[model samples]
Target: MSLSKANKSAYFAWLKHPGHYLFFKIFIWFWLTIIGTVAALVFLSNITAINAVSNEPLYGPMKKNLIYTAKSIERSAVKHKRTLSEVLVHPRLSKRKLLYLSAAQSDDSLSNKEVPESIDLSLLNFTQNMSPQIIFTEKYQAFGPVNIKVPEGSFYLYEIDINHQPPLIMRFKLMPNWMKIVIAIVASLILSFVFSRNLIAPINSLKKAAIKLSAGNLSARADISVNRKDELGILGRDFNSMANQLELLISSQKRLLADISHELRSPLTRLKMATGLAQMQANDASQSYLLRIEKEANQLDKMIADVLQVSRLEAKSQALSLQKQSLQIIVDHVINDAQFEAKQNNKQLNIVGAVDVNINCDESLIASALENLLRNAIKYANNTISITLKHADAIYIEICDDGSGVPNEQLGKLCEPFFRQSDARDRVSGGTGLGLAIAKNAITAHGGSLVLSNKEQGGLCANITLPLIKE
Candidate 1:
């Protein structure tokens, strides 16, 4: 996918993810708060104070002790007046394991001793002004004291060298404490995940319930009676209460409308009969007036029937009698009726598809919806009206007309009962303005949608989308 498309997909996927919101909140809360607090304390206690003196040399005390031992060894040698070979077999040499001090020259028999080989022969060339140096190697370390030359007087007396194992502190090496860090991070992640999940679960349930309620499932409720001592528990309770009240209110309204419409039918029937009897006795001039009254009565009856149908569709107790029917046949019938009406207004009606598709729906309700759309389009169409059908993941039927479309601001209100555009269309066409509203309710009852928009080419387009039946 392209970068923009991939980013959009990832964003929508994250929105759908259950823990997405909680992840960031918990991560920030844990790391910035809990981890930061612990890290600060550890740094102050372990790192900051130690760092002040850490750079100082660790071998200073050992060097001083070695110098003291060297002085004592010199005193012992002077008192004994022993040869360099005798010094190698000295009791002090055998007793000390850490410090091995010895004296020797290349020509002397002591030079062949194992202890003297630990010292370098070039140390005998050291001048009085030069300080002794400590040299470290892989095997052993050697320290040669100042003013100590390899040869002195008749023999090499000041060829003093100290060779022993390296100190423990000096052998220190730096290494990362990765195991502790890994354990800390893993523990943080697990704790944060648990915290976020607990925090977000109720909110997610409430969101899903709200979405379902908005989509016409009034029975949808958060139903989260979790034993949480937080704001979310209270909110969930409030949401359930609100849903129940709304369902009750809407149910009452639907019942009232249905009852009123049913009661109005009796009076309307008697009026139609009275108008028919009066028309039989009326004069030619009064006959036109009687016909106008009859037309208005018929319009009112039609409007009442539409209102009743809308109420029935909205009532959750009413179930649809769905059956498999040819969608093409329905479309063709609507087109044939619309064409006759369109001819009266000097408009051409055309169909742009022949694909026969079957759908599971209430056939009469679906037919009524299409007919209402076609009739509305025929009334407003200036010259040409087109009906187009296509199928993809769902079935799409678009009815368009070449006429000045409704104002952009009023398009959304068109589906509302008794809502008409600020124009002469309704007045001239004698529309009760409930046709589109009833059709919308009928389409919604079938789990379909009816959308109205102005085409880019200067006309109004009504698009209906319905879910396809799986065969």
Candidate 2:
């Protein structure tokens, strides 16, 4: 592949990978911070070095002090009739504060072991001009080769004073400031990149696990984080523990619901049989009560079935059997059944727009969800209900009614199981309050969403969005 294509491929791959973007972001931030700090310190150090060099005190009083100390030692030697080298070792002069003495031959050659190894011998060349010259190095400064004449022989006197600058500052001053800054930046980038990766890697794992858990995958875990021995590992372990508890609690709740629903089935079946037998033996006056009992029994049975379905959906016990089906056809089938129900109640049902979209979904679940929503619209609508279908990035099916809209505050709770707007509505509708909940769950199972909102004109509108199958 061409280089550009290869680069594009890698770029796309990085985008597809989890956590790489976060890692890059963190790395960039850390690298910039560290590099900025290093550059600032380098700049400040350069400023200090420049000031120290420009305002150095070595050229004035320090030079005079060296000359004065050398003259005093020379006078002491002449008075004591001792050689210059011998006089240089006298306790009084040798122990002088802030003065270091070294003696050499007049020719600038070392005459004794007085010179320290740290002082470069090449600096003695400054004395050949027969004038006091200052020599600077990383550690200290030397002023010297002042001529000291004695009967024994001519000697050179030198004074060394420590610079008192910090060793690190002195060493840093040896190199160009720009070079040092460049080196510091490079090192910081490398170290920051590694540190950011190590820090964000675990966080990325936790993020992935969290996403999976939120998406109903109970088994997701931060395996990499769990292996670490740091605080992140502790957090990871706690997260896993929480997930485990949640899985157990939800599983138990679903099992309990399913078991209760199953247990009630047998008794409801017996009750229906007994009701049937009673209706056959009862006279005209008792028949009405028996019919009411049968109707209530049927509603109860539906409630139990809805509870079982909710349990199954929550447990993910029912896997979706996906198929490519025409969404228009499914909507039509649901609308036809709903039209008959609307006619019976003297309400009108109409389809406003048409779309021919094929979607990958569980057909039965999608159909059932639509049926529940259409029936809900038929029940609440005062005079007219409308279905609108449109094709966009996904398929949109909107069912609208012309009745009173839900309260804004209570709109969010419409899909919650066993929730009713008011006791009066609950009694009048005789609903199990699980229809919207089941519909929402069923749509979600097929990677679709059901949204309910108040229409601008009047009444509620239920909008369902299903992903379209790509050909």
Candidate with best lDDT:
2
TM-score of each: 0.65, 0.63
Candidate 2, lDDT over the whole model: 0.76
Instruction: For each of the candidates, give the backbone clash count.
Output: 0, 0
Per-residue lDDT of 284 in model 1:
100
What is the C-alpha lDDT profile of model 2 across 1-471, one tens digit per residue?
Answer: 456987677545645764657777787889889889988877776774532331123467867876787677668777888765576566866675334333345343433235566655554454444567654455565566576665655666666566454355556755576689779988998999799879877886788899998756778887664358898888888888999998898778779878989999999999999999999999999999999999999999999989988777766788889888788888888888888889899999878877687788888888889888888888889999988888888888899999998999898788877788776876798877888988999998888888899999999999988787776
Q: Tell me how candidate 1 scores on lDDT.
A: 0.69
Worst 10 residues of 2 by lDDT: 49-58
lDDT of each: 0.69, 0.76
Backbone steric clashes in candidate 2, count: 0
Which ten residues in a row are the worst by lDDT in model 1? 48-57
| Runs with alpha carbons beyond 4 Å of true place in candidate 1 | 1-12, 15-27, 41-176, 316-319, 406-412
> How big is the positional error of residue 371 in model 1, measured in Å on the Cα after superposition?
0.8
